[model samples]
Target: MAFTLSIPRKRISASPGQIVTALIIALFLAVFLLIPTGTVIYTAFTEKGTGALTAINFIDFFNTELFRRSFFNSVYVAGMSVVWATVIALPLAVLTTRFDFRGSMIIQTLGFIPLIMPPFVGAVAMQLLFGRNGTVNLLLNDWFGFRIPFMEGLNGVIFVQSLHYFPFILINLSASLRNIDRSMEEAAQNLGSSGFRLFRRIVFPLAMPGYLAGASLVFVKVFDDLATPLLLNVKDMLAPQAYLRVTSVGLTDPMGYVIAVILIVVSIFAMWLSAVAMRGKDYSTVQRGGGGLTKRKLTKRESLVAYATVGFILLLVLSPHIGLLLLSFATVWSYSPLPDGYTVAHYTRVFGESSLYIKNTLIYVSLAGLIDVIVGSAIAYLVLRTKLIGRRWLDWAATSALAIPGVVLGIGYLRTFYNIPLPDGTPLATLWVMLVLALAIRRLPYALRACYAALQQVSISLEEAAENLGATKQRTIRRIVLPLMTGGLLAGFVTSFATAAVELSATLMLIQSNSDAPIAYGLYVFMQSPAGRGPGAALGVIAVILVGLCTFLSHYVIERRQKTLGAAK
Candidate 1:
């Protein structure tokens, strides 16, 4: 079917469908973020008796010792985490890139294990190994007649979060190191530069941009996260406030709403600054289309040390997985160390009735992926092409959400949309549109990056060529652009989908009573219960397998289809 090239300028009258789409997005933002939160803010100033304006809420937080302490702890712990993560990751990245080392492959791969786990899960695993009555505690007390205090308060939170988030710093710096022109390093070396001198002169300055990016990511992620703090029982964190408001009191708690608003402001500011500092220039320090990973042959002693370092890193990375795996097979559970002899009982329990969570996780993730890829692709196109109005603002708004943190958004939703009437006052509950919207928004950054990167590769001339050939606007996008973007779409889809499946922070805040909770929720619940060992471990294992399967299927289905089509053509 042929169509006319009458694409109207500025969409003189927005199409009914477009209007509906715009209304939906607007409605989501308004209802989920604006209205509910706005209500709380409005009520915050209102008199306690007359329910009118007052400074009570702000004064309450600023004045109260508890709230103030929590605020300080949030800062103290997150700051320490970022600093330590940088300190540890920098040397590792430097070693991997600069010096020849054995087992570099294993080290590089295991460094990223933390990235795959949800933030809270890391805390849970850490607790199992280091908390009171933990595996290490028991072993130390029995053998060494001493037990180390490694959990609770600022110290523990900072230690675990830093360990979990250091990969961002390491990978970023490693790439930067590999990118520096070999000749640059060679010239410095020939000019009496080695080790500390070489570092001070050439590598350090060149790697600054990458270091900054890694550091920025660490800071933003640690500052905004709620999962690790909540799991570790860190008092006075923003996420717990959100949880307390809805759980202990009700949606009417203005205190929670106030915290949510403050968090949003802080997050937005942090994100803006990070973007300016880290992304002032392009990120690819190493030239593209370059040779594969360069190997430097190490001396015998250095090679031995490198192997030792690899073993240490791998042990740290795999400890929790091993602990969880043992827990999964336990009949008695919680006894630690092989579960006092394994049984298939937990597997039976998990594979029996508790399997529902796996299904729920998969469904929620799939829908979120679709939303992310489609909406993100459209947003990317508008920002990159056609010079849409508020394109800059739109770009900022979309990316800025990443800064807002999942827990904050979850609070924003709880404060805004919790218990609101849905369709004919039917008493519609949680797992509604709001929950899904939170997931979509939380994961939108990945989709946006995928689309933005893909769009850059798709030159405007290709679209122009289609336009010149008399293709309709929609048709041109459908026939030309969408097909080329399957890789990015798939990548975005897998990321969003995986995160949604394992989501904890916002889900905990907003999930309703009697709702069919996702796997993360299931795991959290089990971890706290008498039956925690089997269910938590089983569910977590299921989640990992499903995420892997989703990635495989996405690659197999979408990319494979594209390939077959290309071959046929």
Candidate 2:
């Protein structure tokens, strides 16, 4: 007879634990991340006293001469930095991935040296080495009768940023080049495509995604950077303007919020453009034998040229580090090729008087890293292991922090929390704990990716086996899953800790007392005065060493774990 009407059953894939965990994460993201960000946007659009929606702020932003110049300067510096960074990176990537170059490992390893030290930390060092009266220029003037404006005005900012950030492009482009299918290159070669023509037509287009990704990152980083411009005394840029407006003009000023909004928009646009550029450009290929581009042997002339180019780039890249080490021990270094004299006194002064900065940094970053890995692991588990509703939003919320400049986050936190008083009557925003929270929020995405990758590598069958053996989800996660994810969690911790140790942007706004200042804030403070430069440089060297050691140890640990796991299997 007649068929009965039937309704589809809803899938109830998440357990109560998963649901509760998801709610907790959502609550944290909402209160800490979403509210602070929304507060900035709300302030940017609304009038100061009336609290009514208005476009006057944005109108003022576009109309003001200073704001207009800052806007253009930011764009120009970001664009040129990306260009120069690409110029520096492209040769290295092509040389290493395509040719059997000597000491390629050393070149690649040294390429990453800039990443450990923040651009701002090296800003003074760069100035000392490349300034008009500094080392390189002095030598050039003595020999060649001319000076390069390498550290003059906006040029200084661009130089420091390009050197610090080219590694991003280098890393991404090199990886992309290495992964390229050799078959396509062979096909191009069969069609008479060779050398530069082959690269332009075949290799680069296929690697465009990686280049775009890195370029976008560099653009966003340079655009959003506050300390580099400020340290270089090049304040005609959006980020420094935002920081100055808030710190000097006060948080109530509409200009800072406007700049913050512009920063966010530009960052999002860069990322979007990168994505759009990459759409429909997938060049992945399946092959029977070997993967990646085939390496070619460099001829005698080519080898000489490659080595010289790489050596020159490396020298320029490392000059800041060399200058820093020299500055740390110098009795006086002004307008000199080398220090007038050297001593361990600066390091002794740093340890004796500025030790609190180091201690605060250790505690704060340790807490922040711990928070990041815990939250990151939770989010990774919720998204990967369960079909929890709104789980993907958690990931999106955390990742959105990438687009928010640290200056904006600091402004948002100050605007949102300064009025809320603690039980002792101090404003909640002024507390040292807020510094740790900001660092955690800033570095959370990196930790989340590490945890997500680690979780992905843990076979689902292992979890299924645990569940089938009568273990609860929570029990299985703790006893089975977390043990396997240890490498990823540790990797995530070290990354968060290392990066957070040097983060000064958001903390600059939150730090209320010298006693509570972390290493980065302390470095900024020391670098501000002429007399403190030696101690500041010493502190920077310490930071570089700390980050470098952590990175090396993380790599070693992850590799050892992989080997052990492979052997057990």
Candidate 3:
């Protein structure tokens, strides 16, 4: 009644080295994730003296006004950011993908910049431009005789965060809108439906899945964020305060840890929703033809309107960065387009006062990146290529990190890891584990992406052939699968390294005095230092260089991999 394992539908066989590859991946998850996660939960439930389970921490957490305010702030900010990102992204996706526009490629690429850079960078840039004594403020006072405090606390966080994260919406929405069948839209119009009606009834529903996925991701991202609120000085939010309560205060303060745990739970839940909503949905077809989008070219006047719209977008996105560059170089605060005085002083202080940060940045980023590539690849394989039971949970765990805010994870790790009893019943803790785990977990999405890209290209037939020749699955994979996925490995390696270099929020909480402090964290500290803007700018420049160099290296590696593929074929 049942088929034997000996028979195959199409000469099925495990690839050589598949077992070893799988084992390596399995071991990775066990070491980095299974151990820490297990430890966190274990400590949370049991008190030290009694070793007894307790809901007392949860009760205390509820009673804390700090946490209560933060919870509300986080929810409000997440919701508002979602709304803001959508308002910006929807129209951009529609115009760029659905209609013909001048400079489309340029704008699209520009949109991606925010996506690539971490959210903290956006917050820092915002402070330089829009702060109380920001460049805009000084100019207004000089020219208009009055200054406006545009960078209000909670409002500022929402403003900068929305802009930085909107690209997720734009990129995903464009993919969704492009996937819609043009025939349906055209048919609706022929039935006397106007643009609004056609979009509402036909286009909207079809794009719903993509929008839901994108929105879910954004919600997760906003909910988990730590740095934006901190740098923006928004006391109302929960993530940073929760982190402070643990690190600056005490780990045994179960109240803060409880709040941190809540943030993690909510973020993970939202991302789970995202993964479910977008399952099996592809969004690149909002256009009519296989060749390109089904765009109706605009008339002369219409073209002008499109140009104007595009210009406004560029302005909103570019101003903060452009302004930050000015702020970095300005000798006096609130200077004009060209600073009244310019000096290399900021650059000097950063390198001179804290040159160690540069080295730390490189080390953490490269090591964490290497970890991400090896581990991420294995996890991706487990989820995508294997028949392993409960592999889906692996995807959830890895991707779930994407939903956890850097700050929340920071506090969670601190609260969770700090309490775990080590050998000799002492607290076994250091910045190394914290930094590595922080970078590795945060960058999990990129690592998975690399594996996903490679696996997509390697058909099972190739893997089967290696197996059919009586190659042990492990050997077959080593000789076939690993080599085939080298490009993805290279790309993944480069990505993890680069992101790790600039990663902040979690890095900040993880950093211990005289142990490990990433360049991004150092930059943040110095930026607020009395040594003035001099050292801070230097740190920023150094960070930019380190990041840029690694970015180039990753791109170079990926490019070489592409060339090798072409040559082999």
Candidate 4:
């Protein structure tokens, strides 16, 4: 009667494919991410001459007045940019999602235009419009005998970065606003809460998660940005300092490694702060019927103000594109309210001379996009569908790339792979394949998040039904899951490709010959020379068009898919 019952042990297992997929992901992250990052960190701490551990590098970085100024300047710019971006974004989010108004969609579309154009590409145009002798300053001097120094030093950097990155906050906040349950707002109103009070207490708090996510991203991006600050001659920033130190002082410079370490540390710390802020917050809505926050029709005065406000903001945001277009075609644009003359010669010159850059961009970006989709899909499946151990770590490893500044990654690649030779006897850093790999690694997180979200919307029963019918897990995924996730996959691929095409910092370092440079580097080079500005602007226009087209196409695909699903239901 006292005999213990025999118990069977349950085994946790993953299929061979899942195991293989996990292994591939692990290896990919380890080689491209972990190894390079670890190498950078290791180099940062070691003495260059003796190869011994030392704190001298950090001490030097901290003690240098220039480095200290750069650090504080970066922090100030990042902090101010977040505040300005939030100010611009929050109102737009409220106007668009909370109030029904004419041209709301148009406002949203214009908001996204800034994100499409890379900050550096827009910096030159911004300078032309906002510089001391440029159009706006000239106009102010002529009309009012007064001028604004909007494009002066770090001020210019912050202005350009805020305009460029505000879309992050806008998009995230708008989505969060749309998802908020109407009942919460109604309940607050019923309890005498109204207007800003309601928003501050209920709506804004609920949307805090999304706002923080976007804000942290903006902070990281502005903090680590290299090209914009460099283009604006704001070289005292952390990223530019890192780049200058490495390039000017050579790879043996410990100060360069020190700056790189600081960049990584600050970026990771910002991201961690964002996550910590959202932890244990119950922002979830109880709505299960697919209803969201209710929108109100704006009154006549409110509608007029809303339209005017949106129009003014759109004009400011779109000024860089306008300046770029004018600059591209201008025969002589200096110190003038408008171009002295216009022609298509710049476009022709870009196409005729920099055609290789364009072609290389297409090849590398497409390959990178493909790589992103495949890897993203595998990681998503492993993390979401399989019970594979340590799968979540894969997600974290891939995403950690976001916290890594491109300059840091580029230096890592150089130091880690400089000696490795390719089959053609050239160093791996010189190979175009390295560019592809860098772009892929840089952009994988975006694709992975998109694919993971798409997979989460899919039900487990579909795979179970397939398996119940004797289909292998691989076959089930191929037949059912892949088809279902096509929209997300294509969206992710387009996003990855678009963003990669405009990548500069990593591309700047890894590109070996002029023949191998992408359009971003081409633009950077063109902007460096006064005579090359027109052609560079022309190239910038082309880049913007390519990204805009891809973005619209992705939206179309997602919408069409949703319609198809709805029709079937």
Candidate 5:
């Protein structure tokens, strides 16, 4: 009774290093993510001339017919693109995962090919294949005496976007299909359900989470896409309108900020809807290590039909790459099914006169990738290892960059940093560093996901063991965790570098001088002139090769790491 007055002990605090790291991450996010985004939001609401909050910006956006059309057009195109993407992806996923077919691996590989090419780069090449007088049209005319307007006006934007983004749906749905409990299907079949009925009632509902996730992403991406619409000359969309307003009327244009705000709002709403749709629904299966959905062996007729269907789709998917290659060497390719002449002059010219572009790309993307890995690793450690409060917000903030359109971020940077002077007495907006920073910001989510995934796989006991052996936290991270995550770090770096090298929306806004333009801006400039298409195509080919090589290297590293882990076990 006398000893009952004991005090509760306060929880042990985070280590100093953990505190410091957390502070640094918060500051980094504040400076890089929140401030720029806040700047855009702030500008969107303020009166144009007087700096007072007003609804006139939004009112004007609604009242103007052009702005209204652009807004609705974006919604229309994004909706149609998602629908078409689902139509294309669902059948492909079903064919590949539900049936045993030859070349399934090849089909899956072809699905991923579209991701390697940026939509803008592919937009030009796609036009060569699907345009009015292009290869597909020429073939159609000869075979059936007619041509389809696949690449006409808004239809063109929807078509290119669907092809470029359907892979997201395919990959997600395929994984979902694989993870589904086979017993459910068996039960349904025993009750006389089969074929489309079985899929409609049982399988599809179970895969709803994955399909919704991919569909939401596709909608957000297509809604905020500036490059594809610009490349396809479909300017009656929200993203393109935002870009044109900012560039034409200058940063003080409230309409551009209004559009940016709308873009961000739509993207966030789509993601929230997707999350809410999956909430409170149990899509989980009880099966732990048992067999998954039973794959049916296709009959001879089914096999032939499946192969032919997949083969035709694969041809369309791969057409962009084929078009790029053909255009790169073509001396003249207009109004014909094939290039009139072929030469290496385009390559030589690209190397000879525009060699600076390659150099700039190498330097900027390498630095951006390096920064991404460092930041990504630090974030993963803070969130996964430390008991620090609000650490998860750092991850959330970083990943939220994914929803922010590149054009919006670019406009934010242009407005936010336009007046700040650099050490060289030039505006910060004019520096090459701004371009590098923008690329890093835009691609940070990719790098963060990779690093976070790698870090998650590492056992916490390894770090604890190092700490128990009297090693400092920093030393333990450097000596133990960093080595194990090297493969993931490299993969993240390569992904960041490859994607950043093709970034156009932000680059288009921040590039003040032609001398400082990266490969993406250079390609855009080249493609703007009819005579420069050869050089543009040549530059695009180089970009494709670089990305392809990096992708292969990443795969090799991952496979080797898996093998090493397996052997150690």
Candidate 6:
């Protein structure tokens, strides 16, 4: 018996309400995201005094030795970070997915720890633990008679970024591995393929999409990062050079805009390369009545080696958090493997003196998260439920924020709003709320995807039934749609809030005064001087806790919701 189940495909013009809703979102993107980004691109290509289109800026960029070096250095650092991140992520992904490994769940969960802390927050801690005169080198000199330059120059940035971002690969690759059809593997085995040859020939090729997705992300993130390089005191990178040129030489300098344009180009290039690699290649292998790859059992020796390997990688990745905690409590920690003494004074000082930073961060991030969810939910609804004209453009515009570097967005906001004034004669750009808007814009894509996924899981039949019962679109969404989407909206908010709390690049440019600064900006300021390192470490701990809690909350909500949905079914 053949069962042909056909679903109707139809496109209807949007209702007036949907058109209005889309227009509102379009306006928001145009003003905040599109225009500012366009301004930066325009500034980069135009002649400074004449406002005419010219290629002189780029020609001069290539001609200058320092600028040329910065460009190549950025590329090299980003590329190396991807390589090292893969090295760290690939093994864990395979071990957990391919074998019946003990503590597999624990290892996967711990990988999220590095992401909660910003790369630059860990930069100083890494230096203390790995620098030439630092603890590791001191111990190595005493014991092994030689030291590795783990925290030297550009190596430091690469090390910090790879450790911080490998989870992207681990997560995506693991999901891909879990979805691979076992039938293909069994067929490959029947054909005499086994071991590394089996993995290379059959398994890895199927997972290439996932690997490239993660690797591209790592490359783009490292390339766009500003604070990590600056904190490491490696100033010859493109992002740092852009920041320095704008702040030190003043925004009127053409070099900053030029570098920002180049950053955008390289980012787009990396994504394009990943896409081109996966082009015209079908990776869909899961078939009916077939399951994912079968797990293999490891022998005692293999288990021991696997545990040992996983333990070493975890220690290396978690070192920053460990070092930060020690530094926060330490009275003095230098030229030693551990702190000399510990105290609670750093936390005391943070609460008493720098409490405003925390408060501001909470307020700003909350508002940003709220904005993201509202806007994201609306976009998702419009796209999925309505046949609104140009609805896809809203999705494209929002997701475009991902390609933009934080430093570039900061520069864009400054240029676009610097001269505009409020009722009190203050420049509109100087307002604290602008920082919130930037955060919202920077994180909208994440929230949008979450909401989109949530909305997709909702049956259109439910909404249709409500409409048939005489309910309005707005009323149906408010009563029927929103309640069903609570889980996803909450997840989206948590994600936006967690990541936004640690953002520094955009905040750096948007912050007009110390009073308005968030924790990330405050951390950057405190870490600049030796005397403030303890308090800075304390704030960093607070940030880690804040992001960690949000992450845990997201997971709990998602799991609880899933259980609830299952029970209802």
- Arranged by lDDT, best first: 6, 2, 4, 5, 3, 1
lDDT of 3 at 537: 55
lDDT of 5 by residue, 1-569 (tens): 36677797755357888888789878977877789889999999999789999998999999999999999999999999999988878878999899987778888988988878887787888888999998889999999999999999999999899988999999999889999999889999999999989999999999898899899989998999898898888898999999999999989889999999999999999999999999999998878842478899999998888888887787877888889899999999988999999999999999999999999999999999998998899899888887777888999999989988999989988888888997878888778898888888889999998899889878999999999999988898889999999989998999899889888889998999999988899889888887988899999999888888888888898888789889989
Q: How well is each residue in 1-569 modelled by candidate 2, as lDDT tens digits? A: 99988997777589887888888888888877889999899899988789899989999999999999999999999999999999999999999999988898899999999999989999999988999999999999999999999999999999999999999999999988988889999999999999999999999998887899899999999999999999989888998999889989998898899899999999999999999987776666677432889899998998989899999999999888998999999999998899999899999999999999999999999999999999999999999988767789999999999998999999999999999999999999999999898999999999999999999989999989999999988898999999999999999999999999999889888899999999999899999998999999999999999999888877887898789879988
What lDDT would each prediction earn against the true structure?
A: 0.69, 0.92, 0.70, 0.90, 0.89, 0.93
TM-scores vs. true structure, each candidate: 0.85, 0.97, 0.84, 0.93, 0.96, 0.96
Candidate with the greatest TM-score versus the true structure: 2
lDDT of 6: 0.93
RMSD of candidate 1 to the truth, in angstroms, is 5.8
Residue-level lDDT tens digits of model 6 in 1-569: 99999998766588888888899999999999999999999999989889899999999999999999999999999999999999999999999999999899999999868998999999899989998878889999999999999989999999999999999999999988988889999999999999999999999998888999999999999999999998888999999998999888987788899999999999999999999999999888768533778899999999999999999999999999998999999999877888899999999999999999999999999999999999999999988987777889999999999999999999999889988998889999889999999999999999999999989988999999999999998898999999999999999999999999999999988898999999999999999988899999999999999999999998898898889889989
Over the stretch 105-221, how does candidate 4's per-residue lDDT look in tens digits? 988888988998999999999999999998999999999999999999888998899999999999999888888988999999999998889989988998888899899989999
Q: Judging by lDDT, tell me the better candidate of 2 and 6.
A: 6
Query: Which model scores highest in lDDT?
Result: 6
Question: Candidate 3 vs candidate 5: which has greater TM-score?
Answer: 5
**Residue 212 of model 3, lDDT score:** 74
Between candidates 1 and 6, which one is better according to TM-score?
Answer: 6
lDDT of 3 at 81: 87
Better of 4 and 6 by TM-score: 6
Where's the lowest-lDDT run of ten residues in candidate 5?
Answer: 4-13
Q: Please, what are the lDDT tens digits per residue for candidate 3 over residues 142-200? A: 89998776678777877787887888888877777776777667777889986677777
Q: CA shift at 520, candidate 3, in angstroms? A: 1.7
